[model samples]
Target chain A: MSSLGSKWKPVIVMVINDRKLRFGQIAARIHVISRKVLTDQLREMVEDGLLIREEFKELPPRVEYTLTEKGLALLPILNLLEDWERNYETKEVLAEA
Target chain B: MSSLGSKWKPVIVMVINDRKLRFGQIAARIHVISRKVLTDQLREMVEDGLLIREEFKELPPRVEYTLTEKGLALLPILNLLEDWERNYETKEVLAEA
Candidate 1:
């Protein structure tokens, strides 16, 4: 789990799990994340073979991220986790806390 | 995934996912973990409703840990992750680095 241990790594995977996303789009979707941390997470995933960082030449320049096969493969597990969190692990745990 | 974000948390879960385990069993399986960090992670999981810590009034007093329903529900996801890491994410990524 070390590869995916950070708080933001799986969230980043969640955001771009299905489609390509620009940096701003990702940051917008997960608003609580700081830009530096997001950048660092993305870089790590790219290094780890879980994500593909793409760049396009344009007027202002464009960058996007998408999952590699390795990354896409993680979707089902993340989906299960989301389901578990939503249905079984959420409000009750918080209320208890 | 805040409930499961710690590096040792999922490993701890994996260690005892299918059966009850004593502290020494868990620590032995995940050999690199320090005793203090393992205790802290187990305590956090118990607090978060993912594990049950039990004490037995035996000769020396024995403590064991098991997963709650919430934690058991995570088994399939963890299995998939273990599969992914074993087949796809391990050697190739490490060799590339």
Candidate 2:
């Protein structure tokens, strides 16, 4: 539960789904999260066994993140959550009108 | 996301599920949460439209809490999360052995 407790973790997982993404790429995708918070969240996710942080030995040094099997398992559940929020928001809008 | 951000919110939602429960009944069901925290969580759930708080004009003035449509909708999602955790724990145990 702690793994999913962070608001950004699920978003990050969704962003990095099947593709491996660099830190900058991930930060760029999620506009609301700050770099520091993103770093922290990524670290936590790696520690929780949800993500794999791989570093490439290059001139500038590149790092990429990919989801582990555990993290991949959350996709369907998160999709459901997104659907629930969408429906909830639609209902709220209708109620307001 | 804020609605489900609290650690106790999901637990409370699961605790109340389909049946209406009094404050004491809810507290008794979840031993770890303090009365103050439970009260706060329930109030937030009601405010978030996840719960309905009804007061009975009985001799003792009983009050009960029940899940709203939105709350009831979370059951399947929460169940999936529980299943994920169970599998995750099992894997952890296997890895440790």
Task: Calculate DockQ per candidate and list them.
Answer: 0.75, 0.69
TM-score of B chain for each model?
0.86, 0.95
Cand. 1 Cα-lDDT: 0.88
Per-residue CA lDDT of candidate 2, range B30-88, in tens? 99999999989999889889999999999989989999999999999999998997899
Chain B TM for prediction 1: 0.86
Please give the lDDT score at residue A84 for candidate 1.
86
Model 1 captures what fraction of native contacts?
Answer: 0.76
lDDT of 2 by residue, A1-97 (tens): 6568867887898999989999999999999899999999999999999999999999899999999999999988988998998899899899989
**Residue-level lDDT tens digits of model 1 in B1-97:** 8898887887888789779999999989989989999999999999888999999999988999999988998888888888988878566967779
* Sliding window of 10 residues with minimal summed lDDT for model 1 chain B: B87-96
Docking class of 1: medium
lDDT tens string, model 1, A51-91? 99999999899999999988998888888888887877566
